[model samples]
Target: MSGATILMLVVGAIAIAAAARRYNLPSPLVLVVAGLALSFVPQIPNIELNPDLVLFGVLPPLLFNASLDSSYLNLRANVRAVALLSVGLVLFTTVVVGAVAFWVMGPSLGWPLALVLGAVVSPPDAVATTAIARNLKLPRKSLTILGGESLLNDATALTAYRVALLAAVGSGVSVVHGFALFGMAVGVGVAVGLILGAAAAWLLCKLSDSLVEVAIFLILPFGAYALAEHFEGSGVLAVVTAGILIGRKMPKMHYATRLQGGSVTATIDFVLETLVFGLIGLQLPSIIASVHDRSAAQVTLLVIAVTLTVLIARIVWMFPATYGPRKFSKRIRERDPAPSKAVIGVLAWAGMRGVVTLAAAYALPLTMDNGQELKGRDLVLLCAFVVVIATLLLQGLTLPWLIRRINLPVDEDQADALAEAQAAQQAAQAAVDRLEEIAEAELPTGSTIVDDLRTSAESRANAAWERLGPQDESRLETPSELYRRLRRDMLHQERTVYIQERDSGRIDDEVLRRVQRELDLEEAMLDR
Candidate 1:
């Protein structure tokens, strides 16, 4: 890509994404649509998604960000569902899709090539699924299942893709060998991830500076991916492992680091996801150009047949995957009860594919073992493109409607507010105890400072408790809300004076920045 195109891609994506957010539209879907619309413009440059750049450069951070935002607690709670979707479901989809492709598309896409296509599209896009989940505000359990499934499913799909590739390239792979390869990838990937996650946690703990700590956090994902890949493990799993470990460790770190880390990661996700979907759309012209060998009728038939199969296959798998284990295995029945059918139906519909399938299609070997161009190479890319577009357009657009119609049994937001109140009350009590202990040991008992700290803690806790009380406009402001309102005005005045001091040359820019940060933190707390 040229500099102009790069600039256009970044700027266009950001602007489009911003608009999407303003309109409450799915940014990924909008970006993809924008890119597709832009692709036909002769004045616009042809945008090529380099397979290596995407897999190595693009995939790791996106995977890591998804995992980082995920809840380790929620994941552990729904491990069975996650595993069923990530491992069992991905393999099942591959076999089902591959068989159907071979049977329907004829010898043009033989068993090996058919399996390649299957593996490419087997896993739903992690980036896409999580984005939809957060936007839809699905129940906690449903969100956890979707997030966890997306987080781990890429590893399964990619591993299967490699095994299929080995067969496709005439490396003479057998079923036993393929299973062994998959096993090795999973084992090694997890091991590398755990070791790296521990090391990253150590490094994060040692560094107090939020800036440097976040920088290290930024570097670790790519490093974990590369290191794991170097050892012949699944890079996807390695990055995910590191993310979950780091995420769980985050609560122990300084709040400043947590605040800064959250902002940094959110920004990175926005930029990367916007660019990814935009690229997905822009490749329409090139992807279509590559499929000169296939007739229009043939391409249409394949696209329609495979797209329907991919959608239906997930719906078919969810029933057995949800109930089969609980019926047969006492462990699953005891630990993890089956989710409602409505929830399972939502999960079945959330299978929109994205960048991974596209990148993997391009990652196919350029030539066969005999040194001739690989058969059906363009066909695979075309199939991947069509499936991605179709699923994203069909499923992504209608998912929200489906959720509303099904109405999964989620408790309202009041449940979250009540939980916060309970935690806050306990925290306040802890603070009071600590203050009393210190006062007895060092300061005279009932010192004004101790009294003030105790009151502050109580006020913070009571504000939370007040959320459970009357919230109508007719109600008076609680002590905490009143303090927040008046204090915010005072903070604004303090910031104005600081800026004036800087403008009058009484305080240097550095001093002004330091003072402004303090005021900003106070204001942010009030806003929260």
Candidate 2:
């Protein structure tokens, strides 16, 4: 594509994403629909979907950002569920979907080709799942499991896809050998990711500038992915591992760095996700053009059958994977309470596939080992596209409504507020202790500053505790709340004076800005 076309696509995608957000619609669904519609316009250029770009360029940062934001502690607590869905379910879906595709398509496609199609559509898209789940405010554990599964499942699916693709092209490997390869890829990928993550963290700590720190993180994902792929490892896993590691280490870095890094990643994620889903839709014309020697009825039947197989397989596997362990193992039953049937139903429906499916399908080589055209390659691509669309449209669109209908027990916002209040009280007490200790050692024994600082710290702690207290309409302002309001008003007055001084040429712009920044910080502390 030309530079002009790329610019237009980016602008168009941003516009569509903004519109989607404004209307309370999912951006991925909107982007895909828009791209599909735009593909038919004669004036628009045919933008080819490059598999290399999607896999290497797009997948790494997207995975890295998601993993970085994921709770490492939560993931560890829920490791069993995540592993079941990410690794076990992905492999099972690949086999079940492949078998169903083989049965529907008949002998001409062969087992290898059918399996290839299955592998392509096996993993749900982390980007799509995280985006929708975050917006819908699903249960905390469900969100964690879904997010964690999405992060890791791509590596499993892509590795399986590669193995299946090799077999399809006559460079076949035995089942035992394929499993060994998969193991090696995961092990090596994790090692590479850890090394890269540690090195990046060390560098980030050394850099005081927030912008530079953010820039380093921007490069970290792609570098880790490329390095791991060069060493015959799974790039997707490598990126994810690095992200989680670095995210855990972020608290040790400067607060400004964390703030800046968060903003940068959010922007990057929005742009890349919009472009990727839109690109998925843009490939519709090519997919349609490539369907040769098959009747429309045959194609329609194959798409429907394969799509249903994918959905049903997830539901079948999830129920057993979810409750079976608790039912059989006394330890599991005592340790982890079983989820309700409604929660399980939501989990089953949340397995919507996305861009990774399309990228893997498009990555298939054009020919086999004997130089004959690869059988059913285009058909596989079409089937994969259909599955992505079907799951995203059917599952993504309905998931929010399902969650509302189920009315799960957890209230995420209330839980978050309580947790925040507890943490704040502890932090405030620590600050007060440290302040008194410093005052005793380095200042006059009866310093007024120490008393003032202690009072402020106590007020802050009391304010946090107030959040958990019952609200009374008659008694609107507690002592802590009144303190905060007065402080905020004082800061606002100071800010007004600073602006007036600057406007009247009594203070330089630089001096005014520095003073205003200090007031802003003070106001921010009161708000916090």
- Give the top-scoring candidate (TM-score): 1
lDDT of 2 at 312: 91
| TM-score for each of the candidates | 0.96, 0.93
The 10-residue segment with the lowest total lDDT in model 1: 466-475
lDDT, candidate 2, equals 0.88
- Worst 10-residue stretch by lDDT in candidate 2? 464-473
Q: Measured by C-alpha RMSD in angstroms, how accurate is candidate 1? A: 1.8
Residue-level error in angstroms, candidate 2, position 234: 0.8
- Inter-residue clash pairs, candidate 1: none
- For 279-328, candidate 2 gives per-residue lDDT tens digits of 87888888888996678887888899899989999999999999999989
List the candidate 1 regions with Cα displacement exceeding 4 Å.
Answer: 469-473, 476-479
Alpha-carbon local distance difference test for all models: 0.88, 0.88
Q: Model 2: what TM-score? A: 0.93
